[model samples]
Target: QDEVVGLAGELRSYLSLSLPEHMVPAAFVVLDALPLTPNGKVDRRALPAPADEAYARGVEEAPVGEIETLLAGLWSDLLGVERIGRRDSFFTLGGHSLLAVRLISRIRQELGIELTLAKLFAQPVLFDMAGVIAELVEKSGRQLLPAIEPVDRGGVLPLSFAQQRLWFLGQLDGMSASYHIPLALNLRGPLHRAALIRSLDTLWERHEGLRSVFVAQGGEPHVELLAAETGFGLVEHDLRGVDQAQTRLTELCREASDAPFDFARGPLVRGQLIRLGDEEHVLTLTQHHIISDGWSIEVFLRELRTLYGAFLRDGEDPLPALQIQYPDYAVWQREWISGERQALQARYWSSELADAPALLALPTDRSRPAQQSFAGAHVDIWLDPELSRQLKVLSLRYGTTLFMTILAAWASLLSRLSGQEDIVIGTPVANRARTEVEGLIGFFVNTLALRVDLSESQDLETLLAQVRSKVVSGQDHQDLPFEQVVEIVQPARRLDHTPLFQVMFSWENEDVVAATKLDGLSVTPLETNYEVAKFDLDLALREAGDEIIGVLVYSSALFDEST
Candidate 1:
């Protein structure tokens, strides 16, 4: 995201060549790289895409009017750019939620506009933000106003294991690399070491999260600050002298897989430029899994391609200033999940699941095994298209998500297969509500115990309605932490019983739905390697670019894939 901003000055020239007219940015503000969690996802709330210096570059030619100059100055500081422009687009430059809050506060104080958070994200750049502010700024025509106030936003939920992993990984610390997607890049000429170094430098300067390293205060991983301008370097080598370059690449990759992300120096952050037998050049990015997630890899790939493309075009395409950061979102989350909010949400779950029990029961291969790590096979029997279509119709009629229809189907199947009335199943829930954190990626996801009871001879459609109603209630009460739910409800469990529910079922196929497409690239989908625990069955629906692949990793100790 930062790389997009650094190219702001030349945005109009490059992207305009191949993209639509509105695609270009009017101004750009470069900040430190993006922030990351322990598990290696971009901390959207930590985005420092301020607009305070939005007009620094264009200030020379800008109007001398007090309001206009004052506006430009604010843009400069907010954006962290040396100069600000009157025409800069907030989003085009990089402004996002964290900054939006400040912008709204400024509007209330300066122009008394009472701007909403929605309005700030909508109008991200200087001109648009000012225009919105101008409405109330001119109406009241108040005197000099204070710069926007920064909110203290963090510590939403004490870090979860997933979040901790991202934080540790972002600082270049933590776990070994579990996956690698090797791309052979054609640098377009004889291997030039300097050119490669320049490319790596471009990436380091542009991604704040990449530059960020972590430290542990009181035995917990915390954000350790860094100097943004302090750059990254690459050590070069000639593979032509070696018998085969690919062999060397594989070896280097192996080295990277074992290397942990270094919180002190940014582990797995370094790369080597090597020459193939004749003229080919290879640049490999090996970072630890703790700092980056699979999604983060995709984001990095797209941005790197754009950056490289820009360099090829001899023009920089910087985007607009951002509005906020991950920490800010974290702060917002704490406010949203407290007391009254929690109570309202809790009541929904309490009433919805009243006396409801499990939905899926399967005979165990081992009678309550002590412990197990199982990898089982899976086969999906897709309900006929006609049935799926009918399910959707029912969804619209009942006002529920498509998942409810499928979930009901699963309950029916389990009731018939197990010959039991009561069924128990687990469903992982994604707790993304606030608009700020939706696009800002993290493991803001959790698992919920969905107990669906298939009573004797109940109608299929009727059961589905019950399922839909409960889903709505669950969504409302999703704010209560899963741990808290366990504490409050205190669901009973046996020695080998899964904590809350068994035989998990989830339709995460919606995640792969299309959003935006890049200029020349197709998003290649890869099979996911997600680990599993001890269970009779577990299924996940992964929707890649254009395909939905059902992932079921079961306990081989419980049931064979052949079954």
Candidate 2:
């Protein structure tokens, strides 16, 4: 009976992982024996189907009040579940950040009340969130503005803000190789190279961002969309007979990462497949940061797997058409940033960041270089489960989030290192705050420079409060591009350092689903040593199962290992 129960739980978990919530089986039954036919074969007709009582055992109480009912319906529809109980947790029901964005948008449309992602993080269960929504509805009825239709700029387009910065930096120093984003994966078991190539080609054809190139016309940068025939090709290397397969794969990854992109020409993305053995292979993907961000990588991997699976199963594409492309977003952003909304956001940022420190004075072991080299290494740190749990509790007590708590701690660390009361940390925001661009693949990430004063020795509680307020305000004005903010603030431009802030912080809570298992093959993320620094100090924190894992990336030219 114990073994049967364990197997049942495993089945449920696997279903949740692979299928929509509603599609998951409500219950499982264990058969003691199978009825046999007169010919001594098992009789399928004698098997009993699971009953409604079995499903009811797993169901929670139905939503009671009007608000609960409305919220339950929304959850059920978004999660593809037939019915949702008031006590059901969103995350447990396979709800992710992207789905949460869609849910919040739908809530605004249906309920006439605005909700933020932070609120969902705080109250994830149906009953709790429904109560919060009810209170919000009682206090004020608000409606969201109609989404802007994407503009069709038929001809040429301009570079995005992040892309423009990268373009100018490339012109300044062509040898700087830190702007490349490389991802490597290992595949075990049977693999189809042709199907993989086809899937990649589909991706290139679907997203114009991958087919874009930057060119300078009249000393100003602009993006040119190349012809469909001009696309990235996959390079193959066979190292099956090599004695040191791992080392050879590492060399290939380094070569791929070091290969510089020609922004002016075309095809800023490249792929390489290394065959380690008959059943093992390594796949490396490298793209210029101008065309991709962290979020775009997730989109690419997810779509690649979907297309690959469809092609492998039945030589046909099953993916849906993208409603909008990255270029459409680019055009929309240009127009929207010039409207009254941008001006209002600009006012908020200008006042909030006025007289902020130009840079974070982090102590370095070596002297700074004249021109920034962008060379860097990283150290990994892990927080134990107990401490991580305490941090979560503290975050709840302070009415904040794990991200805010981590940022507070990071600010304190920088203060101790620099002996400066005013510390500024730059963090990247997904900038896909709009529902239209949420699914599009492109460089939509914007950096937020959060300045916190840590001069006076304050308790953790007080520091958390201050950090929470600053983060909330920062999120409110996050739509303003970092480049424009820099132009507005007009910080002292130093050739050796970044403007606004030198140190950076990031918290990743989204769980990107890994590639589905291909027939007789298992795919997993491969660790690569493609080390290069984009900032003086960068800290990225990821929460995994009651523990916090952190990677500290520091500039090699600025600090030694001991420091």
Candidate 3:
């Protein structure tokens, strides 16, 4: 045992020199011989579990006090890991930017102490984070906002800032389906159709937004919560014996996705189940953007997985009852940003966006129309492992994130192509900075217009620094709605383009894009091609393994395949 332990330590140290911190194994085990199958392949099932001590490196220390214990528990819960050590790094344990944002939000919600992303990135270990939290708590003399609680459902509720903007756009566009948030999953196994329906119904009952709609009352949009009996209408089509089943399924999904939602009369959500065979099925769920966002998709899938599994196993609901619903948040948001707070935020945005360019003016294949056609197509791009690695290295050398480095490069490209040194790029923020709304499915995404002013001869490092500073500052004041920002900036309001910016850039983590698992089914996410564009160009990127996969969604009316 002692010799095996020594050997494992030596091997770990040797691997550390060559591998990245995240690539290193948390635990190591040594075996005398390999566990092989009859075909001479490694029998993964036969491998023994690494002992607890294997994960306990000599440098690791257990949580010492109450704060450390609290932080470790939060980390364990978020990372889905068991028994995290005090010295374990969050990133090394698979935490990403999304999780980092959630962590700070959680800390603020639970501890009443505000911490920044830079602080978390600087001190990721449980011990160091705990120490920082302790100091902040001790020095925090001011009172913090109270935790969000369930409000009386009898009163009329106004729409949230984000939701109100979406409502207005819907009015202007006349239910264009451009703001639909859709998720389609391909399932294979002994399918339980009845259980699936029950699970979805329960989900709708649980979140008020799923069953609710926006109703105009006294010339203002207000949320009207529907009854619990609201049916999701899980329409199932038997395509087992149909010709061209896959093609038919694709067409049906496309039609459902493109179907416009009427805010006045809506559950605002739809679900369709297509049976490819006795054991194979495809499920598509679509919701209006007024009710859901990207983060909400994650929450939706997670809750669906849990509810479906419990229902399948005849167990109790594993999820706890939500403390507050979407309507509660909408009411609270209006109350929270009142008096001088709104003016202060507006001033910050006005000053930051002063003298910003109105248009990106990218050369297009055709001339601009009087109004946006909204016709769009996607061009896929990939960065190989080598290039991705080099980019990470560049980010580290410049003291910025991979996102900042990539955005800087993107801005540089735009500047050179458009011959514009002043560039404004719109980016979406999760906007769930407060912990109470993190789990709610609503239109909580806020857009920040990152204006990067580049010199013709500016160096990469300088540009990256400027981008990072702007992103940080913009995020600091991200609470103000983009609609309000536009109203404050009051730029040229052309129907041909959006206000303040024309291009959107967003980065999504792999986990957010990955599919969820069902209890007894093989599940994979199905991608649908939409024929709409919300902006002139939207660059969405996600990391998969060692490479970066990107989709450039462009306006088909303005550019062709060659452009």
Candidate 4:
């Protein structure tokens, strides 16, 4: 047995150096002799299966102290694992870029130790990450992040940096419907209208952002929370006798979504119910971007599902009371982002964006318009299973995420097509770094400008490394609002182009599905594509099974469909 163990260890070491990370065997077994067949040849079918430990990355080392225990618990919760060891690699345990961002946020919120994505990438093991945290805590004197607590509703509430930008834009542009976030859910069974109304009412009452409005007093924007007495109203549209009910339902959804909201009148969220038939119905909900964002959509659906289920069971509110509201976060952010911390972030961004190109020279079929146009269309692209698999393998070999690999390739393509080396692309990040705001329905998403220079003639691996480095650095300094970054960088102003980057790229790790179950209703989210393009060109990709599904949203004013 001792000799077999020794042989296994030797074989593991040899394989570790000879193969890629994904190909490395987690465990090895040695046989005393070969099982022979009738022909005196080794029989592969007679080989014994490896033990359960073969599935784990390495030998298990149980967590020791408090930090390790906390991290192990977080990993278990986030990764959906039963047990984790100190030596287990995060990526090997199904951790990806999105999960890594969440992990860092959790660590900062719980332990008050600020960490960077680069740091997490460098030390993915539980023990190693804990060690790094300990070192940072000691060096920083254990200064913790401020806890978000509910503020008095009577007090004046300020808008968050992100909200302020949206408000300014709306005020300047007359509340364009381009910033509206609409959700349409198709219910295939008997849906209790009373219960759905109660669920939505409870939702608005729970989140102040839903019942809030932006009003300018003395030429300054402020958020005013409405009283619960004025409850949310659900507009009912009976279309059972109409021809082409399904088709009409879609048109109504688009119309409702495109209608602009009045910021001064309050209640930025609107909901409508369309009765197509006895058993079929559609629910359409729209909110201004000033109040909600992409991540808020997930939070909204998850909570709605839970609330609807509980209501059907005659159960009270199953959700815990929120620690703080959107206004509280806005006030806290305004207070906390002052002084030297803000200065340091501003300096970093200014230096990073120094002398950067303001616009991408993408080839367009039409002459430039006098002003920006939102009219757009999307083209769908799919990568075959073989190509997707090869890309994953390449990422594994280079120790990078699939996002980095794809971004590098994309930047290379743009660089070659435009004859420009420096390329800046905008990407959104869920800025809910604090635990208190994780469940809140608000505009907490932040934009990141990742600039990459693809001038050098380098291999794909080299480009991947560069892209990875830029992404990590961007996440490290993501606390500063993109609005503030623009102020510090001071790019050349143009009426026809966006301020910093024209092209946007994003990877959706999960689809936003409003999956729920009432007593007898089949709930499925409906995809309502408004075809609104906020940028010159936007590329969004999401993984579906073994292939990659991509949508290229381009401004129709700049290019033709054939082009």
**Compared with the true structure, what per-residue lDDT tens digits does model 1 show for residues 1-563?**
55454354455445547853234544455656768978899765566554643322334345346655666666566667555666555544434333444444454555545555445544545666667767766676665532322254343223434446455434442243332223323343443344335555666655544554556667676543355566566656677767766676666645533455555556336665555545555555555433344444555555555655555546664433335434444445556567786777566556544565532457656555664344445665444444554664565444344566667777778778888776656676555444333333234555566666788666866787677655544543555666556545556655444555667777652332133122343322222223334456777654343234565666766666666
For residues 1-563, write the lDDT of model 4, one tens digit per residue.
55554454456557767765445544566568889999998675687887654454444457889999899999999999777877667876778887898898788877878888899988887888899999998898566678887788888888999999999999888888879988888889877787788888889899998878888998898889888757678899999899887788888999889888888786788999999889988888899999999888888888888888888777888999887889999998988788998998898899888999988998999976988888889999899877997898777778788888898888888898899999998988888777778889999999989999886787776788899998889888888999999999999988788898999899987777634445678878887666778898899998887799889999998988788
Clash totals in order: 84, 0, 0, 0
Candidate 2 local Cα displacement, residue 491, angstroms: 0.9
Estimated TM-score for each candidate: 0.54, 0.80, 0.85, 0.91
Ordering by TM-score = 4, 3, 2, 1
Candidate 3 lDDT by residue in tens digits, 1-563: 76665454456567768965434555677778989999999886688887755663423456788888888888888888787777676765667666778888787767777787777766766777888888888897434766666777778777989889989998888888888877789899998877788888888888987877889977798888878885667888999889998799989999789888889888799989998988999999889999999889899888988889988877777888888998888878887777697888898899989989888899999998999888899998899887997887676566566788889989988988999999999999999988778788888899999999888677776788798788767776777889989999999888988889889999987555356898899998887766678898999887787789988998998989778
| Alpha-carbon local distance difference test for all models | 0.52, 0.78, 0.82, 0.84
Candidate 4 Cα errors over 4 Å, as ranges: 1-54, 244-247, 514-519, 527-529
Could you tell me how far off, in angstroms, the CA of residue 2 lies in candidate 2 after the best superposition? Answer: 23
Candidates 1 and 4 compared: the better one by lDDT is 4
Error of 2 at 25 (Å): 28
For this target, which candidate reaches the highest lDDT against the unseen true structure?
4
The candidate that achieves the highest TM-score relative to the unseen native structure: 4
lDDT of 3 at 175: 86
lDDT of 2: 0.78
Error of 3 at 541 (Å): 1.3
